[model samples]
Target: MYGQGMDAAPNPWFSWDYVERNWDEVSDRLVIHTTLTLQAVLIALAIAFPLAVLARRIPRLAGPITGVSGVLYTIPSFALFGLLAPFTGIGRTTVLIGLVAYALLVLVRNILVGLQGVDRDVIDAARGVGYSPCECSSPSSLPNALPSIIAGLRIATVSTVALVTVGVVVGYGGLGQLMFRGLQSDYRAQIMTATLLCLALALLLDLVLALAGRWATPWLRGRAS
Candidate 1:
């Protein structure tokens, strides 16, 4: 009698019936998951851009700025959630804070690298034409750095998507909640659904960014052609 339930067959990965019954729930969670990911990435970019620009302009500060973000990146995701939950109190806020912190390293490094990579010739030309450092940066520096910035954004956005699932630690992980519940119940369909959606979301976002990057950098296309 005690072993009877253990003899039952395990559930299959794709349970149409389960999805049919829970599609509304899945849709709601998916929206939450996407919102959290986008918000975190956007916030990180806003913070990282100025930091990257400052680092580029002041070479001495570059190391320390990147170093701090690198340190934040190195901390395990779940551990960060655990640490923040105490102060932020376990929810979207705690999760958003953690996601944003983790994204900084990639976003900052990429933006700085992109800025540094801009043709020195362009900077010299801008100076030769009477552009102030400030005027030159807006028109010449950032535009030239777009590819690298876009690349950084793509990486940060995808990384944020994955990190959002860790929000389960704070009871705010959108699809992550489903994965957690599935784990407890050994429900294969629920876990697979959430995992697949996460993967799909990442791919979709990456594709969109890739397209956007191309659109923004027509010179590269012109050069290639």
Candidate 2:
């Protein structure tokens, strides 16, 4: 029993020395993930917000547009990487493109939901007051849509984190490098540490985003808080 206990127990987490020794590598990889995710999300929002507005106006467009996004989301990440490798090569751009594409599914859907959730009476009142749709929607409707928009952003952020980790599988640097190397080398401690760090990062990102969204959109405080 004593021998079995010793054999079964394993230390699989990062130590202070491990983190200190690799601080630069870890920080650089985290920066890469942050930059990649931010760029991809911004691109997605740019495309998605317009598409969502269009979808709201011409309801018929929503079906096909969302269907296309759904299809893109279902494509295996590695497969998409392979497909893009020919054109973009195996670098950050290729990973960014894939991440943006994946993010669109969530962003567009959320934008659509947010737009649709705007109170029709409020919209009518705004129009009755001689306000243009764009102007009316910008402030009032935006508040109504704030919660949904925040939710979508949250989901997109999470997906971005996971996808960024997978980016290492395609030769793009991130925390996934630690995970991949640890797995390849049969280093249980490193693998566990990497996984925990990734999980912590995801949680931290979500909290920070939520706080930012709440602070930026006061209307959401009533509902999101």
Candidate 3:
């Protein structure tokens, strides 16, 4: 019996039926990951945009904010989640927090880079024409900065997709669940399938974003787009 038990193993990577049998689970997990990533990216954007604007005018605030976000970027997903588990507890909230922290650097840096890339002459012209800081920052600076911001967003989108897959380590609502099951059961086939699916999704997302960015920002067609 012990010998039989040892011989009975899970082969996730090679198991087509494994994936087919759990299609609903895989689809649900994908939805969860998508929602988590989008929400995290959007929230990070909200926080980063204003900070970027502030950084442009203040100059002093930029360094500290960038430094902090950079640090957040360096923290490993599992470690961050583990650390947050105490304060935030487990499940979706903790996962969301971790994803947001991970995204902060990409989102903030992009916003800052976009703002910094704005044409000095345009800004100067806006100021000279009696445009308020708000006006100059919005319609004027924004247009020039759009491409850089979108570029950053493009980067963020890719990062977000990848990070969302990682969220499964938290054992909640991600493809990670499938991945974890495969690993736990020594199911290589399922594992391979899950991994490939994730890779495909990430690649597809990058392609779609690239197309959208190019369409949205004509200037980026050369570099930014």
Residue-level lDDT of model 2, residues 1-225, one tens digit each, is: 111355665444546666788788877877787788778888998888888888887899999999999999999998898899889988899899999999999999998898898878877888898987676656344577877777898899888988988777579947788888877766666676677777877798899889977787865566666
Model 1 scores worst on lDDT over the 10 consecutive residues at: 1-10
TM-score-based ranking: 1, 2, 3
Off by over 4 Å in 2: 1-12, 128-131, 139-141, 217-225
- Clashing pairs for model 2 are none
Models 1 onward score TM values of: 0.91, 0.87, 0.85
Candidate 3 residue lDDT tens string, 114-224: 778787888888889898776777623467777667777777877777777666656664767767777776667667777777777778877877787667667656673
**C-alpha displacement of 22 in model 2, angstroms?**
1.2
Distance from true position, residue 96, model 1, in Å?
A: 0.3
The candidates, ranked best first by lDDT, are: 1, 2, 3
Task: Indicate whether candidate 1 or candidate 3 has the larger TM-score.
Answer: 1
Better of 1 and 2 by TM-score: 1
Residue 219 accuracy (lDDT) in model 1: 92
lDDT of each: 0.88, 0.81, 0.76
Using TM-score as the measure, which candidate wins? Answer: 1
Determine which window of 10 residues in candidate 2 has minimal summed lDDT. Answer: 1-10
